[model samples]
Target: MAPQLDTQTLGLVFQSRPDILAGIQQAADTPARTTLFNDIASFVYERLACADAPDGPASKRRRLDIAQPPAQTHRNGHAQDSVPPAGSQTGALGADAAVADPVLLEVKDISVTAPQRKKYDLCFTKNFLYARASGTSVPVQGIVYPWTDIEHAFYLPVPDKSQAQYNYVLLPRGSFLPTAKQASASAVDRQQPLEPLVFTVPATAPKPGSIGGSSAKTAEAVSDTYSSLFNWALTTSLRSAGNHSCQLVAADPKLFHSVARQPHRPNEKAVHVKAFRGSKDGFLFFLPTGILWAFKKPLLFLPLDRIVAVSYTNVLRTTFNMVVELDTEGSSDGSSTVEKEVEFGMIDQGDYQGIDDTYVRRHGLADRSMAEQRKAKRELVENAKKAPADGEGDASAAGGADGMTELERAQQEAEQRLQDEEDEMEEDYDPGSDGDSEGEGESSEDEDDDDDEDEEDEDEMGTAED
Candidate 1:
């Protein structure tokens, strides 16, 4: 007689049956279908363990407790009688159970809306990362990245809606360049360029209109303080206060030692030291358009828009430094674009903070001021076009007395002036005119006398020859 098969063994046998596996695959609902697959997997694992048992099959099977139900009851008052499905907790304590544990890093079926982009639900695991539309599963996208890929992550606030903010993770292009050599062994093309990636995580709080709310206020305060300090510096300094179009925004007076490094010759280092007392060494200027470091040598100008960030640091509580990060033009090397950080040291700590705040605020306000100025100029031009011409209202009030508008009257006066000029020019060029004719007649008489003398001399010469 065949050995009597237990329920767990029967489950493993069902999984091995091709027809049953095909049926599970063809199931309409994914959740129910996956549950069936998990149940099959759990049963197979238990059956295999029983076969390799140190004790007899009966003892190994008893250890599994396959006949026992879950201690917790369901809302419908039914106990879960089967072994916990794969990817679920069975409350068993062992190395095998621990190895089968799963961690939920993120949830599925949840949509993350991005700025000016479509929504997607992203799922990440230890081995794979994929994204799909919020509800559908027809198309799935995968992301490939190095383990050490660098990312710039920041929170971006949405307008009006308080709870609709987003967290942006910017994966810059070539962030994985350092590990490209290792990745190239597996990649089809070793030299293929990598594109940047942006991932947006939706937030569930009140959205802000702009980033750095408290920081912006602090920046404003610092900027004001720096502006006052600049005025004081300019008054005391011996450097000529050059007239500028815009108001003096901020200034910094301090010494800076520049450390230059040669990329080609890594071992070479050059240090250039200078002092800015406002006389020989020029001071730094923060204008509406850009920031300028004015020195006796050529000045360094960085546009406000090109500036990425400003960071302040204090060294040993003695020296203060301000590092400005700027998005500059590409280098000669055919590498990806990067932000360059320029450091200026030997500044007052308070002044350094002020300068940093001023830099941030200035960059934020760069376009706003220009936009306002443009709008004002446009309004002025429009008003000028709509306003009455000079003396137009008076001329209109005078009615039919002068049958011309102020503009027509001005045109008439202009035409009269032009006519007078032309008449004077014609008179000056006319030979028959009173003043010019007298001078012309005297010259004509002298020419006639010369012709008569020539004719008389020719007659005498002919008579002498006969």
Candidate 2:
């Protein structure tokens, strides 16, 4: 039986390892807090019991398939087995054990630095990128993303936000899976894919107040040059089309970051700076012809046909950052080619829907309004199916040869009541009826005038007698 742990001991364990709680919270379908606590308590109890057992360690080693040393024959002809030394190079043990695994690249001390900065240790193995919070070995918080789902990895820097500075993110290459309702309606063969996840790592930068701190000013100069270029591009594109044919869908004055890096080249270092202006200020215009944006320089006339995909990163409930991947030619070696992606940061929350709508329309995706209509129609059809057919009793209660549901009958009754009330009110306050009321009012006024005259005569007679 598992050892029993008291509440106090369980609380202490939880306090010592807060990552357990964090793991529970990160679950996609998180249980109630009380249930999670109870589960953790039970787990701790079982672990403690296992540790306390006499043969627990040996059993664990056996379960892990740890190899035992060969048995030796003693002078008495009795066989005895020797225990393996600690950290022995036997059966999945020792320093080189991980080498046998399929993991290709593993990097620690990395932080995701876009939308938000989060420390994560990344491991790439067998076409899957596994990520876990830095400094914690908990597998529950680890996420596995397939390489095919990853669209691109690039650097983007935004001003006025610390987390956005020196940021690199991996965006998803495809659209999200069908919603729960949609999946139920259709025969979905596959499970839902994960939402667009942005894995970010920060770039190296000079410390504040250091000699290299002047790089900030240099970044500013670069931003100004880009901004000027952007303005020129916008003017040039608009000039080519003399008529204002391009309808503006959305515009952002200050948004975007540009970074260029060539790892194979010796002198190539990652550059992270505001995109258009020194302050990361730039404009993004969604035009009918396509999308246009400028920051340090303008990316003018990016035709929709050239765009491969558009993805978004939610930024702390305030905004969404857009990532646009373009289909471009590869370098001669092909290996040296970069995946062309543009990041538009700090977009207004309200404009997200419109931008997404425009993207879907341009990319031949289902129309947003049409999708909504279909969803509503499906709901109506489902409700109709769930509703009962008119029974004999229901038809009799309706008292009409035309078949009607309870709701229709109720509506007809309500309309009849309303009509009757309106007719009564109209008769009570008819224009022709108002004339009789006016004549009666005049006769009453005349009678009142005669009464006044009589009272005056009585008063005059009394005065004469005095």
> Top model by lDDT, which number?
2
User: Model 2: residues >4 Å from true position, as ranges?
Assistant: 1-102, 113-118, 135-142, 162-164, 173-183, 187-189, 205-303, 306-466
lDDT (CA) for every model shown? 0.36, 0.38
Residue 130 accuracy (lDDT) in model 1 = 34
Q: How does each model score on TM-score?
A: 0.23, 0.26
**In candidate 1, residue 320 scores what lDDT?**
45
On residues 276-367, what C-alpha lDDT tens digit does candidate 1 reach at each position? Answer: 42244443445445555433233344556556665543322223445566665552223433437555555433233234334455355322
1-466: candidate 2 lDDT, tens digit per residue: 2212223323323544567645644551423443444455445534433332333565444323321211111112232233222112232221112111244434554454322346565554333444545444331121444443443232233333433233333333322111113333233433222333334333343223321121234333333332232223223323332423322222222221122233333243222222232256655544333454432221233455556666654332334466666666532212212346656676654454445543444456332222442332211011211224554244333233455433355568679999999999877885765456666556677899999999999999999999
The TM-score obtained by model 2 is 0.26
Residue pairs clashing in model 2 are 112-200, 226-296, 254-282, 275-296, 276-295, 276-296
TM-score of 1: 0.23
Deviation (Å) of 333 in candidate 2: 29
